[model samples]
Target: MEENQELEQELAMEDVLKNYDFKKIHTGEIIKGSVLKVTNDEVIVNINYFSDGIINKDELSFESDVNPFDVVKEGDEISVKIISTDDGEGNVVLSKKQADEASIWDSVDDAKKEGKTVVVKVKSETKGGLIASYKGLRVFIPGSQAAARRIELNTLVGQELEVKLTECDKVKKNIVASRRVIEEAEIEAKKNELWSGLTVGEKREGKVTRLAKFGAFVDIGGVEGLVHVSDLSWKRVNNPEEVVSVGDTVNVFIQSVDREKNRLSLALKDVATNPWTLVESKMKTGDVVEGKVLKFTTFGAFVEVADGVEGLVHLSEISDENIAKPSEVLEIGQTVKVKVLSIDAANHKMSLSIKDAVEKSKEYLQYTDNEEESTLGDLLKDKLSGVKFE
Candidate 1:
């Protein structure tokens, strides 16, 4: 009986010592546990410690609508990070998501060093880019770093992508990723494959990707070609949008290709007929042509006399009187009758005059050449004879 009693005392003492030893473990330590009970606000976990640990609903997932039953259930083993000791109510604070995040940071650090690609699912949309989930951790991708080709970040929600870990801060819990590097690498590979057969003056079909003031961007296969606005059409174009818009599939003639600089000069006008080639045969000097007012500057107004044929009506010849601006007398898109005073097909210049035409028509009917010369001399002598210098 005495020996049995001693054995029982030793077993009880061992149990007490085990409980004390469990209590010595601290908060922030990762431990394995089993789900004991689940509630709307918190979940009870049996961590094999002195007391059952309590995991708040917020710690279940970074997602806001997470339900305890969806994440943890009765008798399911999970890993949790201790947040605090028992709150004196026999409840120890623990977190599941935080522990997972800690592990994710470790993996992210390793992946960054190895330059490894990681698969991440976009969790939410942000102003700069998309918020993504990688092993329960929030990762940020800046807008500029999102892709080689621009993408709608909002549409990427719930979409999975392969990204490279570019930056990581375990202290601030900030992780930054880059899809641009991967995208750029792929684009370069595609360009190399396409460039092998591409040469200057080659023809290619491409989609217009972007329109700018100076030019339009064309996606020729995976490479980009620049078709300057001047090269868009044989006719004058004020804006690239007037000739082509985004997503326009167009056939472009490659004018020049610089492989070293990765530059391509494209021309949409080259594929079309040049209007200037027939200008001398179709148009003549002294012809009264109706033209549209294209643009006005301080020097003159450019008028489209014919298709791809433009003439400048100098500010001096626009009206009999000196006008401050052409806009005052002429408006955009207005048709006007102009006499072609001179046409230089070589230089692409046509001198146009509105007042000279009227004057010439009046002189042709009323004045003789001898009579006009005598009268012009008499008027000049009368106007200048009285002017004397001291």
Candidate 2:
């Protein structure tokens, strides 16, 4: 019985000694505890010390305004730093906020060294950067690093973004992050996926992002493709902007692609009717047609009779009277009537004659004294009979 009583007394003394072991604690030491009681402004934690430790609500987190109950509840386990072993009342003064800050700063250092990513929540905007939080530690993200493009700052508030630590100063408490770090990688991955699946002749829907004299750029998800000026429409296009404006949703067909160079040749006209075929179906040789002069060269004038269809009028065919050059009789954008002298629609070629058309009018006038008008066939025969082969 005496041995049993001594064993019980030893066990009780061990338990009592364990409860009053706060003397072993050092200032600024981090220790684990469980919440014993929670109040409006303080959380009573059992650090298994001499007395229950108190953590003020203000020290619950770095945030200026915090509620103790919101952060901890009875029986919840948390790590706290011993701000003081005894506050003169034999009680430990603990700080959960300081512990968290120290731990996060260490993490920030590791992230910078290892090039790791961390999540940040935007809290507000400052003059040159956005005020953000990483596990309650303040971080500054410059405006330029917030995104690949300029973005509205107000919309970013309360938003969470993954970022890379670019600058960290433990003494100054200055930490900087860049959201663009992750964004650039995401953009590249998206582009790679799009390039891998893209095929020639595939039709894609996109929005016109910008226009240049040479082409228009379109965003069809992660990649941008160029629609060259000549491919904007079946008709002649002097400027890409003339055919498609910025922000216009356009349907285009991929004409060709170069994965190595990350380039795409696109055409808006391939899906539409071939204008050359339309010209063939509507016009025949000796048929008079109205056209507008498109350009001039030393030898002839090129005129457009229909969309995407042009015919060349040689110097000899410009008029019966001799002319030094086609410019003497025709100017760009000048509307004139010409006879379709020959057409090879399959090859998209056509020859026009202004002098022959005038001669045909004269033939009608002279022959009209007896008959109405000679058939185009009879007119052709007369013209061919007069030709002398060299």
Candidate 3:
């Protein structure tokens, strides 16, 4: 009878050992279970262990206004972090959201190290950018990292995007994603592929993708080239929009290439007839020309005599009267008549005057028909010699 009792006691001890496994709790272990009951205070989940686990309402969400029903319901399968074993109640305190966050951070770290693209779903909009979900983990995508072009975060809600993991901090539980980096990498790859056989002075068709103050960005077969405002047209341009608009198809000449910087300088005017080529033949010194006022500086006003050809009218020569500034005498886009005093083709400069030409014309009228013609310089020297100094 004593032997039989000893065998029965051994069997009972084996049953107890099977029931209480004494599982080890590590830092980042994912414990899965089913929600047995949920209430405003806490959620009870059964993990088929010795006892059910309890997750407090506050641990259910990172959001402040969290409702238990929104997160879990009865008989719903769930996962939780084994925060700690129960005291005397024989229950385990768990955190569903925390476990998910820990798992996500691990994945994010791996993605960044391997340069892998992660698929994320847009969850909500924040002031700075969008909040996204990746494998049940919340990640932040700043506004500048959202796209290669500006995009509205509101429009991206509920959309899935392939993003590269830029940063991940397990201690702070912060994860940052960047879709722009992936886009830029793709663009650079495409640019390198397209530039392999390209040569200078090559003519290509492109579409204007962006118009900035200084230049327009054109897309030529997935490669972007910059056409500076000065290269857009022979005529002076105040704004890039005056020459090209976003989405406009245009023919451009490759002016230069910097493979190191991945820069391509494009020109629209190079492909067109050069206005300066015919300027020297059509215009000469002492010629009366009509021009439009283009810009004014402190010292002078620049007049557009022809396309890409501008002559400066000094403030002192704008009128016989004294003027403080060129703007006082000339307004932008106003038409004016002036005489070209001199032209230097090599230097690309033209000196213009209105008062000097009028004086010269008056002196010619005063010369007698039978008298020998006197040069203007000779007359001025003779007149100055006769004046007595005090």
In terms of TM-score, the best-performing candidate is: 2
Give the per-residue Cα lDDT of candidate 3 at 346. 65
Each prediction's RMSD to truth? 14.3, 8.0, 13.7
lDDT of 2 by residue, 1-390 (tens): 999999999999998996676456899899899999999989999998767899988899877788777788899999999998788988889999999888889999999999999999999999987999998888999998999777987789999999999999999999999998789999999999988888888899988999998999988887889998878887778888778899999898888889999888888887557788777679999898889998888889988999788999998999888899988877899998889989988877899998888888788778885453457667778889968889
lDDT to native, each model: 0.86, 0.88, 0.84
Rank by lDDT (best first):
2, 1, 3
- lDDT-best of 1 and 3: 1
Task: Say what the RMSD of model 3 is.
Answer: 13.7
Steric clash pairs (candidate 1): none
Q: Write the per-residue lDDT of candidate 3 for residues 47-83, one digit (tens) a residue.
A: 7677788899988876676899988899999879888
Which model is ahead, 1 or 2, in terms of TM-score?
2
lDDT: worst 10-residue window of model 2: 369-378
lDDT: the better of candidates 2 and 3: 2
